[model samples]
Target: MSGERVGAAVTWGLLGAWVVHDLEELATVPGRLRRNVPQLRKRFPQVPERVWRRAETLGAAEFATAVGVMGAIVGTASAAGRLTGGRSGLYQSALTGFGLHGVMHMAQAAAVRGYTPGSVTSPLVVLPFTLWARGRLRKAGVLRPPRPRDAVAGTAAAAAATVASHVVARRLLGAARRTS
Candidate 1:
């Protein structure tokens, strides 16, 4: 297979895995909320049902989006680096991906908060899948000799994916809300 095709395959594979994780989280959100209700109420006396619902929706959307965006960024970067045969290309890609994560997450927070997106909670939420992708990349036969640069790239890519997913998911949510 061609290099770009290989990269795309890896990206899609990782994204698919993330979607599965999203589904699992959605299934458990209700129980998680039930368990945390008392604390939620105590912590935020003015909490609303809409907030809980939004959280649930965003959680699922973000996961899928993150996976998609991160996978794309990483695969593209790695492939490009390999094609060009530049030593720092991979590191540069990784750094870019890592930084992108912060951006995506911040955007998600803003979207969730209606423009004021508060402190950093997204990184915490998306970390699992991001980390999982990294692990998978290392083990996969197609993508060999994962480097330190990859770790950085993986992180940034994951963050960017988180943000991208959030934006897409939020738009979908808005459309659904309007129609419903």
Candidate 2:
């Protein structure tokens, strides 16, 4: 197989894998948080009231809007990867963040002592796909050895994107509420 073709596949595969993993999250997050946040806050009082309050505010529509915003970002990174043959820093950074996100989901589940959004697919799809794609990128000679800065950059990007998406979601919801 041509490496270029394989590289494109690897890059596009990231979006596909993310969609699968996030489907679980999209399906579960709003309801799960609604059901458990009160108990979770009580049980883990150190988690901060704002965190609990913010989580409680997430309705399905708001969460879906956030997912759509994040999808656009991921889609852009995947396109960059495809165009650059897996050599794009945007693609690599997103890939790293996606993998770390899976790890975080596992930890979230453990910390909550129960199922959490994305936990089902974190191991099954997200992490495995990330590792496989990274290996393929390495074999294609486009891989950069990760540095501490890469991890920090990836993590910060992920966190910032999430926050931005939520902000967008909230603004959209507010606008809709006003119009209605």
The best candidate in terms of TM-score: 2
Error of 2 at 103 (Å): 0.3
Which candidate number maximizes lDDT? 2
Which lDDT tens digits does candidate 1 get at residues 66-103? 44554565556555544543223553345335434445
Q: Each model's TM-score?
A: 0.37, 0.94
lDDT of 1 at 148: 76
lDDT of 2 by residue, 86-176 (tens): 9899999999999989999999999989888999999999999999998888878787898999988898999999999999989999999
Candidate 1 has its poorest 10 consecutive residues by lDDT at: 1-10
Query: What does candidate 1 score on TM?
Result: 0.37
What lDDT does candidate 1 reach at residue 150?
68
Check candidate 1 and list the clashing pairs.
65-165, 66-161, 94-153, 97-156, 97-157, 98-156, 101-159, 101-160, 104-163, 109-117
The segments of candidate 1 whose C-alpha lies over 4 angstroms from its true place after superposition are 1-16, 30-144
